[model samples]
Every structure is written in C-alpha cells, then in structure tokens.
Target: MVLAAAGCSENAMYDLDGGAMDAAVVEARSLEIVGDPTVSLAGGDTADLTVQLRDPSGAPLAGETVRFALDGRAHDSTLETVTATTDAMGLAHSALQAGTVVAAFRVRASADDAASVSFDVAVGDAGFGSMQVTPEYVGERETLPRVVVGLFADADCEDDFVRRDPGDRLQVLSEDDELVRFLGLPAGVSFAVAVRAEGEGGTVLAWGCEDRIAVEALETTDVDVTFDDEPLVVDGSYQTTSVFPTTTGEDVATALEGARDALLPASDATLILDAAEATLSGAEATELRAARASGFDATYQTALESLGPAAAHEALIDRLRTELTSLTVVGRLRATEGELDFSVLRLGMGAGELEVALTELTIETSLDATLDSEELRVSELLIDLSASELVRALATREAFDRLLDGPSAWLASAASCAALPPPEEPIGCDAVCLQAACRTVLADYWTAALTVIEALDQERSTLELDGSANVADLAGDLQVDTLEGSLAGEWTGPSATSPEALEGTFSGERITPPR
Candidate 1:
C-alpha cells in the first residue's frame, strides 16, 4: 500500500514511495536577534522579539523552525516565549509578555546547527526613567573634550566607581557639552551615577559621584554634578624659593634662563676687559697721530688719559662675581585664581657698579588653569620683566652716562689745560695735541659702552616659557613637573635665532599661612 506525496518545497521533496526525501538540505548556521539585545519593559507589557536564521553564506534559510526558550526556571515564572516559523526572508517572530511582577530575564533563540543568541529583557514596575545630568565646572570653565556618564547598580558603585566595569548604562556626551541624557533606565530602584571629565589627551580632569539617586518610574530625574576646582589643594599660599634646574632638556624656561645666566657673566667680563683695551688702544693711537702732526711726542698726555680707570673696572667685575641667580614665587591660588609676587635674582649693570638684584616680574597674562583631585594644570607660564624694564629705562641711561662720564671729564680737563710747552718738550703739555687724542679716546669709549647696554637689553625679555605643567603637593609643598617648550625670539641687540628645546622640574613649599 504505497502513498504518494505532492507539492514538495525546495527544502524537502517526497519520494515516489510516499516517503519523505532530502532534496535541498539547508541547515541554520547562525541565529541572531533582529534588534537590540537589551530591552526595557513595564509590568504586564509585551514586546516582539525577532530572530533571523542564516545559512553558511549568510543567505536567509526560510521555512526553518526556531524555538524561543528561557534559560533558567527563575524566568520561567515571570516570562514565556513562543515558537515561530521562519518566513521567506528567514525571519522568525516571537512574543514576550511580562508577568504581573517586575523582573529581569534573558530570552534565548535556538535553531538546528546555528549558534543561539540572547535578549536581555528588563521588566520594571510601571515604566522606566530617563536621567538628565548637568555638569558645571567651577574654575576656568574650559571645554571638556570627553564626558562619560555612567549609571551603575547601586551595589557596584559602593566602592571606587572608576575601577568598576563600565556601568549597566553608559553614555558619552559630545565634546564641550554640558548635559547628557540616559534613557530607558530601569526605574523604582536606587542607582549610583558617576561622571568623568577628561581633557583632549583623555587625562581624567575631574570626577563626581552621587549615590542612592531614585528615579520615579515615569519621571525624568534631573541631577547636577559639580566639578569644582577647589578640590585640587591649590588654594593656599605656596612659596617656591629653590631654583632647581632639574634637566637641561627641552624646556623653554630652563633654556632661556640658563642661556642668560651663562652668557651674562662672560659677557660682562668681556665688556670690562674690552673697555680697558679700547681706552688704551684709542689713547695710544690718538697720541701717535697727534705727535706726527704736531712734530713731537705726546706720550705724557696718553699716559694721563689711560691711568686710574683699572680701579673702576675691577670693582665692577668683583660685584658681578658675587651675584647669585635665584627664583622666588610667593602667591596664593585663592579659588583657583590669584596674583603671584614673582622675583628672580638677576645680574644687571648700573651707576658704575655691577647690580645683582632681585628682578620683580609679572606674568604676561592670568594663568589659564584647571584644578583636579591630582594636580593643578597651567596652560603656560610667561615670566615678564616688569622690574627689568624699569632698570633698563633708569640704569641704561645712567650706566651708559657714567661709562662715558669719567672718560669725557678726563678728555675735557686735558683739552682745557693751557700750560705753556711745545709738543717737543714734556715740561708742560700741548693743549691742541691733547684735545685731538682725547677725542679719539672718547669715540672708542662710547662705542664699547653702547655694546654693553645692548647686550643687557637683549637678555632682558628672553624668559618666555611655553608648554604645560602638572603641579601637585610634595611634602606640603607644590611640585611641578613634565614641563616642555622652546626658547627662541629676536634678540633685542640685533640677532636672529631658532628655537632651542628646554625642560626642568622645581618644587615649592608653603611659607605663609594656610600651610
């Protein structure tokens, strides 16, 4: 008694003897939920879960039966799944209806020869809540490049939120943004919210956390996070008296200061020595020319002009040798902003004496700063010569005057002498010959003096420090590190140069109140 099968599909064909026959055998190779793996639902709500069945080549395998099942018995009582058949597009649809109680469950889909996928369905009492977070930066409100707002299960946020895994619901806000929203968070339960503010380099600039924040099932929770700069421990008085040049590496401040310190001494010494040489050379040369013109030797006049000037240069050099280079910054960072009393022990020349004085300085602008739990960050530190300018204005004129004053007085005295004697005899003096020699000596003296003034001016404004530094506490003081920048600018004395790399480290201790 043989039966015949009719209307067989492409996946299965019937044999002539009425037995089922394998025609085009297609097995499910992969299965995945059509949409998001996680879904939120209120009590007694239903959501459609769709799964796609695919072959080895990812072509849809139609007419396949996909069984929708729950993983454990815990979810067996709260939620249930239904079986469905794959359509022509290899998609199977199933319905998930939550029970009266609010609970969470995972739905699994299985097909023959295909890996199963899961859907995390969270059921809340009534509905879900949306969290809107607003962040306010208290100091130097620069735009934060990255803001991560995390919503964690109240238990996981008990400890350090930064060390935990990315929370149950995490969302990143756009750069320089002030607000972020997290939608569809499970409601009727306490949650801990943690926010992290980051710079462009992804360094964590600020952190804020709030716990036991409750969200009504249907209401939007408005939360505020304050990233106050006051937490950085930089508000008190700090005095950085030690000028430790930690590295000769690529740092603008170090290179500029170092180059000035190194060059000033050599330059001053060279200037004094050159002044003597110029006076001697100018006097003798002028005497020679005057003697030939006047038909007699003018050696006595030359000796008078060049004598006793060694005492002045010797005193100047001695004063410069005892000078010390030091940096002292005394100030307070009140509410992350304040002015600093800045001073640097610098070498200067004034009033016929070498000046080793404390140069009062000021920054070019207010500090562009941000303070966090770890450190205070400054965008750049530019040391400007407020004191140097005053000295340059006052001492430049006076020093140059004194430089020519002594020489000019000597020249004038020699010129005005009317003692009667011919250039042929050394009994008295030839006033005309003496005046000519004095003129030549004064010309060379003024040239050397001007060179010294220009050299001092060139080094005056060279302390431009570029780059950023992290300032933190070290044994109750401020420790600064990681400074890097370049030193290059037009020399005020007429020279062009390229930037040289510089680096260094310095620390300061609190010397005043609030220590």
Candidate 2:
C-alpha cells in the first residue's frame, strides 16, 4: 500500500508542475479606460496594443510568448500567437491587434522561468477596442517632426480599451497606446490636431483635424474631445486631428533690400573711380573717360557675379544696371504684409544679367512665404529700372537746335562718327558729310529727348554736347578762350519747335537753315 501511494504521489506532482508551466500571466496596459474600446476591424486593419505579463504578486515576469485566438468561425484563423520576452523584472508585453470580431479575443502567455511560468490568462468578453487623436505642431523655417494627442470619454463610456500603437513606434505612447490628450511642443511652430475613433465591432470612425492647437513659445492650449450622434445613434464617438505652421518672422524688408544691393560694382571699384577721376586735365579727361568706361564694364561684371553677398548700396547699383540691358520681370513680393512691397526682375537668357541671377544666394525662403511653404525659387534676380526714362533723361535740350544749324551740323556729324558706329549700313565714304549726318542725328535725338525731359518735370537734369562742322573751325573760331572746351546743355520738351529750321549751308560738315 505504501509503495502504491508513493508512486501515485510522484505522478500527481509531475502533473502539477506541467499545469503550472502552461498557466498564463496576462494583463492590459492601463486601468480606467478613457474611451469606447469596442471596434470592428476589417481584414487588413491594424490596431495598437499594450499588454503585460506578471506573477500573482504583480511583479513582472520574463520570457513569455502569448498566443491569441478569436472565437468566430469567420476569423482568418481562430488561433494566432505572438511571442514576447520579459525584462529583468519579468514584465512582458504584446501589442494590440485588429481582429474580425469584437467579443472573440482570448490571450494566454507562458509564465515560468523553467521554459514556462505558472500563470493565468485574462480576456474581456466584450473584447479590445479604442479611439485616439493627435496634434501636430509646426514652425516657420523649421520642420515639424512629430505630433501627439489624447482622447477622453464620458462617465458612461465603456471600459473596454486598447492602445492605438503597440510599440509606440508609429507614435510615442506614454501610459497607453492612445494619447487623446496633448502637451508640450516648442514655440517655433503652429499646430492642428485630430483623433481616430473605433466605432462598432466592424466599423471605425475617423475625425480629421477636429482640434486646432496653436502651441506658442510659453503656453499650451486646451485639448478636449467631445462627440455627438448626429444620426441619433445608440452610441457616441469622438476624435480630433492636428496641423502646424513651420515658420515666422518680421524683417523681410531688410532681407529683400539686402538681396537687391548685391547686384552692383564693388564698393572698392567705386572708390577707385572717384579717386582716379578727380584731378583729370583736358588730355587726362579723355584718358579718364576711356579708362572709366573700361573700368566700369569689367568691374560691373565682377560685381554682378559677387552679388550673392553685397550690401544695400551695391544692390542699388545692380538695379541701375538693369536699365542698361534687356530682361523680364516675373513676379513681385512683399516682405512685410503692409510694410513693404517689391517687384523681382527676371533676367532673360544668356551671357548677361539673366545668367547672373541664377547664381545661388542664401536667403531664407520664409522671408516672404510660410516656413513650411516651398522655397521662393528665383530663376532670375535684378533691380527694376526704366531704360526708356534713362534714354530720355540723357538727352541735351538747349543745345540740340544750335548743333543742327549751319556748319555746326558738319562738326557735330564728325563727332558722332567718333562716338558711335552708324546704326545702319550705307555707301560712299565722305568724312565731311558723315560729320554732318552725325550732327543731324544728334539734333533729332536731342529734340526727341527734350520732348521726354519736359515729361520728367525735373529741374536740373543735364547733358553734354560734342559740338561740330569743320575740324579747323572746331579748333579755331568756335574755340573762344572764354568757352569751356566741353559744351554742356540742358533742356525740356518743346511746347513748340524753333521757328528757324536748318538747311544745308556748308559742304558736308556745316548745318544751314532751310529756306
């Protein structure tokens, strides 16, 4: 009898050990669930989970694999298992899952150190479900990295709850998979938030940007979630979404102006020209003019190339240069909403200013657009100036009529050839006649200019004359000691033309009154 009892006892003890190993230590992430947890999951829908494994003492246990099963026959499979390993304290977790049925979940985990632990499995008969919301905070000139929010349900809300993300990899989950409440984002961005609600067993309701949270530098806005059944449904659901702004600021005017001044001749070149042109004599004056023109051309290109880092003055110079060539103006911008206005000149194609504007310049895009908005891509940059006005302004009014008369036409003609190539092609070389032609053209231009000048309505705008006819006459009779070598004159538009018009009076080089 003793021998039989011993054998029986040993067998019972072995069975007991096996039973302990198969027992499950199961847990949910948090108590006092915040929202309706029951949800209908479609075939591919994913739900977040927060699970825990522990011993009876509430101490976490380790190395646990939990198997999940659904009761409904329509489930892809009634048996689906997930393996989890506990931390040093024996605490382990399983993320939430989206399943076909709400009331069909059963979970169990191994609870022992010897390949398994003694434990128990716990599951809700109503099943796991949850709803959530998050807010995104953004800034100007800065990227909006991430956003989060929380949800709250009425006292009548059910306790059946699951998290939105299991590992919180998709979103950072603190105590639960769902963070329906929001807090703490820096002042650099603007934000809007929203929530997702798991409706019934087979349905999910989503609320887009239901919450607009503008997190400022020093404060956090309120995050509240409330919902109603617009259709007079049996249950109520709620959710919210988040949006943000990426940039902000005040000094756009200064920024744009700084961008402009960079388009000119170097400050150093301006200084050099000033110093060099100061003491020039008659002969030196001619030399200075040639040198100045060459210097300007070379320095202008260099300055234009260096525009990316120029000051305001340089920008002004660049704008002036725009009047010197051909270009297009694409669009304009206002840095300060009401404080400033500007137009951007788009340089046309090829070796001139257009190519220059294409060079990279480091300007903050948000100076005009939202920080999150696209960069203010500029294919061309230039200063706006009126070439036509410059043309009109440079004409000499008072002296135009005189140069077109008698021998003066001939001398002026020669001077014109000396200054610029004739605009059109012609035959028969006659120096005297050519000189007269220059005088005539110059007269026409000046008169046209005078017409423009009257329109300007400016007081003292002036121009210089290259006076004319015979070389000898220019060198002698017209060369009165009292007369300045340079003939400079100023004029405005003629209300009427001179009563005395000129006719050909002297051979080739002279301007004569027309009879």
Candidate 3:
C-alpha cells in the first residue's frame, strides 16, 4: 500500500507542473517596452524598438504574437498594424521610421489580452543656426521709414532658391527692436543677403548687401551693413581716339588762322587811336587825320594782298564751309558734390591750322557731368571764348569797315589816285564810282568776319553730350543743334597722373551763309 501511494504522489506532482505551465501562458496579459519608452530620430531616419510580453507573475511569456499600432503615418516605412511573434526571450522587435517633418508620434504594442505599452518618437532635426544683422545709416533711422531684407542662393543675389517660400521676404522693423532670426537652415549651403531702406515719399535712402554667407549647423552668424547719405565719387582719367567729319574738303584750322591773321593789323590800330586821342588840336589834328587815313589805306592794302588771288578767296570760303563733325577730347574727371567735373587739358584738331594754333589759343572747356553704371553724361558745359586773347583780338576786325570805310574811300578818290577822276569841289560821279569799287572789297572783309563769329558761337552755348567710360577706354558723342551737327569720339588714359587722350570723327552737311 505504501509503494502504490508514493507512485500516485509523484504522478500528481508532474500533472500539477504541466498545469502551472499552461496557466503561465494564459496569464501573460501585458506588453512592456524593453528599453527607453521614447526615442528621438532625424527626419528620414529609423529607430529600432522592442516590446516584452509578461505574465501576471512578472515572468517572461514566449511564442505570443505582439502587434504595433502607430498614432501617425510617415511618407516612408511601415508604422501601421505590424505583427511580430515573441521570441524565446519574450521580446518582439520592430522599426519606426521618421518622416520629413519635425514632430512627435506615439506607438503602441499589444498582445491578445495583454495591456498595450505606449512609446514616443520625435522626428526632426536640431542642427540649425541663427543669423542677426545690425543695420547702420548715415542719417537717423527715423529718416528711413521702412527696411526690407532679402536672401538668395547665388553670389549675385539673384532671386531664386528654395530655402524659403517664393514670395516671402523679411522686413526688420524698428518697432520690432530690429532683431531677425531664421531657423532650420540647411547646413553647408551658401547664401546671399541684401538690405534696402526707404525714406520719405518712398525713395530709397540706403542699400547694402553681403554676397556670400555660409550657414553651418548649430551656429549663429552676425553681420552689419551700412547705408551712406553722401553720393559716390569716382575719380579717374580716360584716353580716346577720334576722326573728324569729311563733308568739306577745306581744313578747319586754316579758316580760323586766316580769320586771326586778317584781324592782326586792325587789332594794332587801337594803339594808334589811343595816341591820336591826346593830339586833337589844329596842326596835331591834321597830322592825326593824315595818320588815320594812311592807316586805313594800309589796312585795306594788307587785306587785299592777303587774299592773294581768286583761288585763295575761294579756298578761304571753302574752309569756312567745312563742318566739325567729329572731335575727341580726353582728360581727367573728378566727381563730387553731385557733379562730375571734366577737365580737358589737351585737345587736338586735325593736322591743319587749328593744330598749329592750339598752343597760342589755349583752348579748354569744362563739363558738368553725371555717371551711371558704365555711362557718363554731360549735363552742362562751360566754354568761355571771351577768355582767349586771340578771340579778343578779333573784335577790331569785326568793326573794321565801320571804323575805316569812310576815311579810306575819301582818301583814295579825293587824293591823287589813278582809279578815279580828280575830285571836284564836291565829289562827283567819278569819285562815287571809285568809292563804290572800294566798298565792294570791304564787303568781302565783312563776310570773313561773320564766318569767324558764327564758328566761335558754337563754343558759347549748351551742348548735348552722351558717352560711356570703362576700365579700358572712354567714348562720347557731342551734338550742337544750333550748328546743325554732331561729334563722336573716344579716349584712353588709365593713369591718374599721366594723361588721358581722346580721338573721334565728325559728320555734318556743309553750312552756307544766307544770300
């Protein structure tokens, strides 16, 4: 009976052990996260997660199926109802992938009657920096009422790139304490920034830019920009080459010199007139009259002799007809006080009379100009012909006929002159004929005088000028409407102390005096 009872006890113990194992499997009612309950991941990255199955006695339960359910969805990776069987260690493994946004998501794991365990995952990047700018103005900030800042992807600041919305721009207002911050900038990318300030009437008061600023992950960059109230001044010299108008075959320089030479003796007559002014009584008066008459005669003779022949007369007239179509004047420029001042120290006309007389005439002119990008504009030009002594010398010749015509005509016809009959008590028809002949010659002198004045008038008025200047060369065109013509030219002068030179050519129709 004792042996039988012992055997029955052993069988009962084995059955009890099997029943405990079955109960343990049925009692696994909860899932617990094996490691950290929360995981952090960058966008487009993944994290491994594990959940353990446990019984009511806190013992591991194997071969149970665990399922995962995510609160949110990503563009990539499986985060829905994913199922995995627990291994011998009672752990089920899964992976959670992050999307392209920065946020937090919840993930829950459960098995049969087990209570679900919740886990959190943060999806985003923390590798961005900040940028701040301090803007400076030449005047008060109040004078600049508005400011705008722009960011670009190119060194030239062209308005393209995807760092921001296409139409979005930044305005740093004084009311906002002038602090600006940008977050989530991608690392290792180049950027450019620009700033502009608006004044009263919406005018742009100041502007500046930073062409290249590299933003790094987890860093901050500081920049400063300045806007100046004063105008920019560019001081430099230029060189040029030129060609003149070829409308007329005559040389322009020769015409000017001829006019000058014709008036030389007449200019000297002023001295004789000054001496005669003091000796105006009886015999002295007679002597003065005779001296005056002789002077008049001599002047007429000199003028006639100068004409040389009919061909010479025509040559002089042809020279006067030649128009200056092209001219080049190169010099240094000093821009300041809202004006560009151009000083032409050297100028050359063709290799004719004008070139020879340049030293003696001292021709010079000043231009008030404005500059834009690569262009130079002449706003006003000051050319003073009266400043030249040679020009002043022309005054006597201009009035020559008025001063000497009467005296010269009287002396030639009344005195013993072969060209007329002897003067009677009153000058008769024969004397009149001789006087008319003399007047004919005086008409030619007047014609020459008028031509010189007309040419000189071109230098006395405002001119329209357009041109451009670059690092290598400078060029321009000058138009004088009153002269009915234009001059185009170019110049070169790289050195400041050395000289800038210019050359140009001209074009125009021949000018004829009114009949």
- Please give, for residues 1-515, the per-residue lDDT of candidate 3 as tens digits: 00111112322211110111123333456567888765656778877889988778777888889988664322344463388888887899888877775443356676786545556454556654446766666643334545555444323445333212211123343433554444434345455666655433434445666657766666887767655532222333332232433311233345555666663334322322333334355665565456555564355344344222232234334433442223333334544434555444333323322221333444455666565333455544443322122222222222232343332232222222224332232211234433344344434443554466455343322223443332211111111111112233222112223211222332211122111
| Residue 176 of model 2, lDDT score | 23
The model with the greater TM-score, 2 or 3, is: 3
Compared with the true structure, what per-residue lDDT tens digits does model 1 show for residues 26-81?
Answer: 33376767887667876667888898988879989899999876542213224344
Output the lDDT of residue 273, model 1: 28
Ranking of models by lDDT: 1, 3, 2
User: Could you tally the backbone clashes for each prediction?
Assistant: 6, 61, 23
- lDDT of candidate model 2 versus the reference: 0.27
After the best TM-score superposition of candidate 1, give how far the Cα of residue 437 lies from its true spot, in angstroms: 25
Name the top lDDT candidate. 1
lDDT of 3 at 506: 25
Error of 3 at 361 (Å): 10
* Stretches of model 2 off by over 4 angstroms after superposition: 1-150, 154-326, 330-332, 337-340, 343-351, 354-384, 388-515
Reference-based TM-score of each model: 0.33, 0.20, 0.26
TM-score order, best first, reads 1, 3, 2
Instruction: Give the Cα lDDT of each candidate.
Output: 0.46, 0.27, 0.43
Give the TM-score comparing model 3 with the true structure, all chains together: 0.26
Name model 1 segments beyond 4 Å from true: 1-34, 41-128, 155-158, 162-166, 175-178, 230-515
